[model samples]
Target: MSKFKKKTGTSQDIPTSALPDIIFMLLFFFMVTTVLRETDLLVEQKIPAATQLQKLEKKSLVSYLYIGKPKNAALYGTEPRIQANDAIISVDDIFRWVTEEKDKLSEIERDQITISLKVDQEVKMGPITDVQMELREANARKVLYASIKKVDL
Candidate 1:
């Protein structure tokens, strides 16, 4: 053998100069693709668990209606309330709200709009029924009841 030693198969150190860039790209991708919770839940609306659940294919066609008791009894009182967006709304307001929401979309897409009901499990059916009637009057027939998927331990 000559003075030079034989080379052994060994892994070379990976160049980490672009590691930060790769990490930044991954971070940016997750930030862009993550589905942020659309609504700030002001009420105590713990959705009831269910066996079967279906995901809304198109998020744009969905409008959320929150029905539950106010978080602070001192401020909003102890009674249950219907929240359309940021404010607590009366039952009659549903019709106008639905109409306005529908108008935002194209006329052809109006019929495809789904009113998602996020009602509290602890609340009674009276308020829910009232909301349903209001939706019916508003002609927003596609109503979806939002619920948590039940997991059997």
Candidate 2:
């Protein structure tokens, strides 16, 4: 009875090192379960939102722009839509590119295609508007800005 009583009272079965492991595991589990915010762009800008907005249907023509610490022009163009938010392309270059592409296409084809610019939310009106003017000069019927979702020409 004494042996059994002593065995019950002084239990040496449990490992002392396991306490930290269990605590660490629990902490890790909670930390892993916590949600983290994601980064969508280089610079954070508070863009004005609409009350009721329609989602963009065509991802094909979608372009992206990032406003970083130093450079403001960061464009990403892909197939069917050239993404050029990286190095800033001036109005002259824009005009040249559009005109060159326009010269290749027929009048009918021109009507089918439209140029859309995705600018950083913080990017000023000067450049954005300049691109718009350039597009118009190049004879691009419909010019657009990505963040705005509408042309501000």
Candidate 3:
């Protein structure tokens, strides 16, 4: 009724100036904290403990061989199996596998390649011996046995 009019509507806007900053911060956080898994273990590994252990200097020059019982016993059976990379392979496959792995490296670094055997504690020496024989045949002389540090009680 007077010179001034009555205001009834209010603003409903949300502040989004910090939205991009929040999103970028979240992205950076995940990039820093996330760890990518290299391989999926098909077999159960319970490494044996050793008193005298030496750490490998260059992991890139090492090829890993996992020997243990299959986690899916019903499918792969209860016997100890050999795993190279991701697939389960046989004893005879060791020679071919070693050759292929060595071929992937430079000629100079070929001799420096180390074969690391990660065998389960319960597995018998028969499989280990077979693997060693195959490695010898392949001329991959440098071998390293993977083991945990023995903790004295």
Candidate 4:
């Protein structure tokens, strides 16, 4: 009878010298590419879901308009309000706000600027209509309705 023995080799550990560099590169990539929300939402936004949704072409040329009830209804009332940047303003203020927003861009870029309206689904059409009229007066014609993608069940 003959006995055979199998050879065993020592395990080699992976080189971790480049690990920190890889991790730092990934972190920097995310930091640079991620678009952090510039303004916090003071009002509750329940964006309606839609089947047909398109991505906004240019983020730099886009300004957001939030319309919904204030997060703290006790302090700001339950009525729907317009939120431009960080401030909650009346519908009448939309013109000035749009003007200021448009002015931020150069003359060549002005035509490409889009005003994205984030309106709550539960809200009435009156406020939306008023905002549209104000936007027209402000000469900010490019408008977009921001909504979530509706999932098909």
TM-score of each predicted structure versus truth: 0.80, 0.42, 0.79, 0.81
Q: What does the lDDT read for residue 6 in candidate 3? A: 80
Using lDDT as the measure, which candidate wins? 3
| Alpha carbon lDDT at 16, candidate 1 | 94
Predicted structure with the largest TM-score when compared to the true one: 4
RMSD of each: 3.4, 11.1, 4.8, 4.5
Rank by lDDT (best first): 3, 1, 4, 2
Error of 3 at 91 (Å): 0.7
Full-model lDDT for every candidate? 0.92, 0.51, 0.94, 0.91
For model 2, the local distance difference test gives 0.51
What are the runs in model 3 whose C-alpha is more than 4 Å off? 1-35
Model 1 regions lying over 4 Å from their true place? 1-14
Per-residue alpha-carbon lDDT of candidate 1 for residues 1-153, written as tens digits (9 for 90 to 100): 699887897889998999999999999999999998767777898999999988889989999999999997888897788998777888999999999999999998999999999999999999999999999999999999999999899
Per model, state how many residue pairs clash.
0, 7, 0, 0
The true-versus-predicted C-alpha distance at residue 104 of model 1, in Å, is 2.6
Q: 93-123 in candidate 2: lDDT tens per residue?
A: 7767666555566666655455655444555
Name the runs in model 4 displaced over 4 angstroms.
Answer: 1-27
Candidates sorted by TM-score, best first: 4, 1, 3, 2
